[model samples]
Target: MYFIGELKGSSPDLKISLYKWNSKFFVKFETPDLEQVYKISEMDVSEDEIREMVNEEFIEKIITRFKEMYQDLGELMGDY
Candidate 1:
């Protein structure tokens, strides 16, 4: 089975999609021009629990990674 939903209260510039299938959860974070996906197990945890905890945690991580990536890109361009 498959299920999908949007993360409520997320930033307009950062849209988050949540999906569940095959006893696993898949989360996608997207902006106008960029996207990232994260997969995690559903083992032992209820879907509600995942929604409450994992979703926000993953989004925070994705945002942090994007920030770091952009910072590094700027530094690399500065070397030129």
Candidate 2:
């Protein structure tokens, strides 16, 4: 895999890694215990465009979910 780009300081506490393998693009998001991968292909659109869209939308949703999960864990542990 070749490094494409990274979105850092764009989200709260997470960083997104973008990679390319041949004709496919990979979006990776990692935390302490979880790693998420999203694949993009050149179907009707260029891979570059898809990568941009994933950065704007998919990564946002993943960060939101991570925040929600962290909050839930804190509440469960009575850290409120």
lDDT of 2 by residue, 1-80 (tens): 99878854345456678788867778788787556787876454575676557645666688788788777778988954
Q: Would you list the clashing residue pairs of candidate 2?
A: none
How many clashes (backbone N, Cα, C below 3 Å) per candidate?
0, 0
List residue ranges in candidate 1 displaced over 4 A: 1-3, 54-58, 72-80
For model 1, give the 10-residue run with minimal summed lDDT: 1-10
For candidate 2, the TM-score is 0.58
lDDT of each: 0.75, 0.71
Top TM-score prediction, candidate number: 1
Candidate 2, residue 39: Cα displacement in angstroms equals 0.6
After TM-score superposition, what is the CA distance of residue 76 in candidate 2 from its true location, in Å? 14
Total clashes for model 1: 0
**Per-residue lDDT of candidate 1, residues 1-80 (tens digit):** 36578876468888877888887888777876667777788886666875676556667788898788778878988999
Best by lDDT: 1
